[model samples]
Target: MKIVAVFNYLLSFLIAYWNTESVAEDEFIYGQFPSYFRWGIGTSSYQVEGAWNLDGKGENIWDNFTHSTPSPIKDGSTGDFACDSYHKYEEDSKLVKSIGVDFYRFSISWSRILPLGTKEKVNQAGIDYYNNLINSLIHHEITPVISIHHWDLPMPLQNKGGWTNEEMIEHFGDFARILYANFGDRVKQWFTFNEAWVICVMGYGDGIFAPGVKEITETPYTCIHTILKAHAQAYRIYDLEFRDEQQGQVGITIDSGWLEPSDPNKLEDIEASERALQFKFGMFASPIVFGKYPDIVRKSVDERSKQEGRSTSRLPSFDKYWTDYIKGSYDFIGLNHYSSYLVTSASSDPGPGWYGDQNAVTFQDPSWPETGSTWLRPVPWGFRKVLNWIKNTFNNPPLIVTENGYSDLPDVGLNDYGRIEYYKGYINNLLKAVIIDGCNVRGYSAWSLMDNFEWASGYTERFGLHWVNFTDPSRERIPKESVKYLRKVFLSNGFPKPTLPWNSIQLNEQCAAVALDPDTSF
Candidate 1:
């Protein structure tokens, strides 16, 4: 018996060694996310499915927005011919399966589905494109999680006042109903909006992203109101008309980044940071979960509205029925987490007051991770903390981590150990949030399956675990070491056993066996 115990111990040590053996400079994150977690990758229409204005598709807001003024995006770049996944999704899916992922989270371009963004006339060609895409995924045994919209509103809608129009609620619902009728059978999951904060602030208020309009007071606030109403309308439509029949869940994707103070002991800085979060993630989450906007947002904005002599709240209010209608519309919360920052109250300076009249404090973390992008720095602990904050604050809503990844400089090399390290750190923190802190995390999809247009930053930031040769006409795909590494993990059912041939396909069998046995814990 003693010898058997000793033998088991020996195997454990061997497994650990093999897993970490010659691992590059990054991979040492500690903690676990959750057991039975789903793993996959992500991409969006404009960024990847670049069939812009192709195949009888009608022009959406992005097409018009980008074409009219391309300078607002980071590199004056547009998604005219992104990764060309619109034509080459088969090749893209091959890369996904090669990594042995079980799911693929992507968005259906509104313009692609309803060229004019209406239910009155469905675009059969657009519908066929997604039908084939969904069918291809299922053929490869991959689950498809679809986002209904990812910030690319149709140009016609904008001309009609876009989110500024209360009628958008019905318009968006019409769109959702059409999506449900066609794709509901195969695509069981859906996200209504990608990130309201960025869509409102960067896209409209700051004129940074597509549909670039700038620094307009009350416009961003009004957009949020219309957006919330639209989300509620679409969600109610799905629940009342399609959920039971289709057997699917629907939700909205909220962009959340952790806020910290440059000096933890400074009361003003801490207050400002918390307020920053309220403005960003809370503006969305609080409404759905707690049945109202963040108290601070309501209070501050009301005063601002009053000071500006607005007769009502800058934050819109729904009738009690609509409040309830919007409050519990989500089945789960889709989160996009990339990094955290330290925000301090603006000290009487003249920067546009974003999160309440505040000060500038650069985003800092003593030992955060870095991606290829200059604006983003990774903070794994921030992820765990953010999850816990959401879990506790929102009464533990089920969660699907829709997008989390490290964007490094393009051509960082095929063996991007930096990315591998980023995954380890974030995934570990995710597990800690789930197991240790009790956040209800169900799945994780890395930011991208393959790098594409990357929006304003253009094609410069590569977030894919698998690299794409954008310059190559064929747009060849190459698996970075992360593809193999994450495959080892997913195949292991968590972390690969530290044993010989750590990257071996045999580990997948072991993982399948363990997953089936129901006795494994990560």
Candidate 2:
């Protein structure tokens, strides 16, 4: 018995060594990534799927929000006819194949599948539409990564208070069951929600996004609680009912801008950075992973609620039953990181919003490169910092970078050296996180396959490998110079050794034709 135990221990050590040999030998000095690492791009249904009311499609909150308020969306435009991907998805699939990616991540519109957000009747047309899209992806040898919900709730559900209501738990579960029943055989990776923070805070607290409400304290908490429960329910349903047969993984995508202390030497600044993360990504992530809100978050929110004369904490509390249900609910954690912000302790509260709750002031360094959106500034090193944060906080859960890309200003032609540089910096750091720091990072996906509706910013901010011509009725998709660079990186499975400068690779003729003057900045 003693000799057998020694042999088994030796075998275990050898297996561990062999598993990490690639990382151990390379030391992440070069960007040579694990050959199995994936490179893909994504698009949300509402953002890219036009034909809003076509083919028995029901309305979503975005459809109502945009059409109801004439100027709610930026540029006074709506996603009603945004990219027309509903009709042009074959072209989109061809574009995905052109990029030579392993997978394509996309969301299904809730209303498209269940017009009234219920299982009373499933729309065959909606099922047919997604079947066509999924089939095309499989045919091209591109795996389909599907997000169950990406903030486009059916308008009928919005009428019943949407994510703020507990009924959404079962409603969303039914939606998940339908998806699993239909697509689970081919779809191995399932994301329950794209960014629960954005869905809860932006939609309810700020009133800047869909189903805009602006209730701030109570509504944001309530909405997020509902979303968390819904997510857990869907995960449990999949784990119990479908996971065995489908052999798939289910998780949720949580997004946040990396927060750094403005003055790292000061405890107040450091605490502010921690609080910023707690309020943003940790709000949704903690419940699903750790089974409750962070201790700091619970204490802060309860104290504030008491001071505000509330009978209960403003942040919702999960019962023991729900807590256990949500704990260990995810197979992986999806991170959609874009930029980093310097956070400082706030002297004055901003008032009545998610930012107000954190009591922190955030600003971008002027030295950072600005993108189309004022809020976005590339800080490549922050990628590894945030990844390490997740590693330590979640005890090194498998992570997929579900979204990361640089956005260029509209009308900027395809000489996207800036975006190429952005990708190189972030992806290089991601490789370091995986190889050097030992973060169980599995995959990386660019923000989008092509430019489409960019939420409230509309089409003004372009974050696509392919430049989409929104003005053209046909919505021509043009591959940017960055696409070529990205393809080479995907083919190499990492940054090529002896990295080339952004401008080192000559642009193809199609990209060169649209290049700005030699003196112009990218």
Candidate 3:
């Protein structure tokens, strides 16, 4: 089988790498993760939930984007019937329990809850759907980790300028307040927004995502400023009004990646790497950790804006009120990291928008193995590097790794040996960060539970531990070897005792024998 061979190759590589690397003397014992370390799986509403127009759910920007005359989605597919999870969450909950995860991290659909994106109109059907999901998870003793916004902004808000409009602060706060009032008692961990960088940079700066507007110029900066304020308001509301009563923790999830300088000895390359980081992670994180934009970002954007004939600095400034409110607002740092980039100082403009705005360029090493997705390349060591960077830069903030996974096209079948290697290397590096480097990571959630609509990629790419047959009207779910692999990791609470060369072909055959069945409840 193709999968068996891939597994063997991956194990051989890992064993060789482990033998050569200089490990710390005081490294935490393998497979001895702390008792409280949480393991979970992640999914987003727009990407997974179908019934897009059913149950009075208001149209979100994604709905509009996918339905546009000239759709940008690669496969010309829309998420209108994605997994039908909106109608079959009971089945989803069971899938989570079967995997032995401690929690399920899923986002709330803003348009589903508030059709008008305002408190004046609450959709009872949307409320009912989520309530049923929460109750089911609770019944199974699986904790619910909620993300308040995950890019499915109500079309009404998009029509009115979305994140770019400062008025969004009140809209988001009110929407968050509604969620807290209803579900705060049961849901203890809350993510105010999922991947602020993707929402701003991909959505506004690059025009590749929903409500597509390519303003690689200053709009992304403005969008993130408003988003940060909105996040602060939601966090503060939960902090002041609900934390004592409900005992829940609130924070935001950021999409950050490790950046390796193209030339370690060159100052220009090192600075370029830092600039890339500042433009992405620091754009949102600085407002939370330092209560302002990074100096590099401010300086670069200001200088570039002036040169481009702008009247003032492109980077927006927060008042003392907002700065104070945004600072120190998180209970934990929720990070969603996937691949790392090799960065170098740009000799010329990289492109329009954020690419050019950063004054740097990123490329991937040809030697690194690629996943099904063109963007994802496995570089496990970078995972530890980024984690250490977070530990030092943010003073060892408590962290929940919200998303990480590999993608392969659906035609690959459910063998998914590549995904197994991806998780193993990244998770092993994560353990090194926590144990040897002393980074304060408390949890890890693989990017998704099953393959669903992958945003712009549509149904072309699969990231789920379990594979879903999109062409099947029943939306059948099938277990991949990664599921069995991860379930073992969950049961062990860390790396398995022998550390995974699982060296025997018989062991690979045993893993390959796991069968797939349709979830009955769906």
Q: Give the range where candidate 1 is weakest over 10 consecutive residues by summed lDDT.
A: 16-25
- 1 or 2, which is superior by TM-score? 2
Stretches of model 3 off by over 4 angstroms after superposition: 1-29, 350-352, 496-522
The lDDT of model 1 is: 0.75
Write one digit per residue (lDDT tens) for candidate 1, span 1-522.
546534543343343223333332233333334467888888998888777888767777777766763265666667878888989988777777887888998888888777777776677888998998899999888999888888888887888877777888888999888888998999888899999878788877877676777855667887887888888888888889988889999898998877766676665665566567778888888888877888666766777668777798666766898788778878999999988887777766443235443334546665665568877887776676677667655678999999998887555877687777677667766765665556788888888888778776787788887778877877777877777667766765565333336456886666444322323433
Q: How much does each candidate deviate from the true structure in C-alpha RMSD?
A: 10.1, 8.1, 8.1
Could you estimate the TM-score for every candidate? 0.87, 0.90, 0.90
lDDT of each: 0.75, 0.84, 0.84
Ranking by TM-score: 3, 2, 1
Over 150-221, each residue of candidate 2 has an lDDT whose tens digit, in order, gives: 999999999999999899999999999999999998999999999988888889888899898878878988
Model 3, 1-522: lDDT tens digits are 546534543443343334325564223234457888999999999998998999899999999999997889999999999998987899999999988899999999999999999999999999999999999999998999999999999999999999999999999999999999999989999999998888888999888999898887778888989999999999999988999999999989988888877886676776687778878877888889889997777877877878888888878888899999999989898989999999999999764357787889899998989788888899887777777666655677899999999998447788887887777678877887777667799999998899999999998889998889899988988888788778877767875444235667765443333211111100
Candidate 3 collision pairs: 216-353
Candidate 3: residue 468 lDDT (0-100) = 92
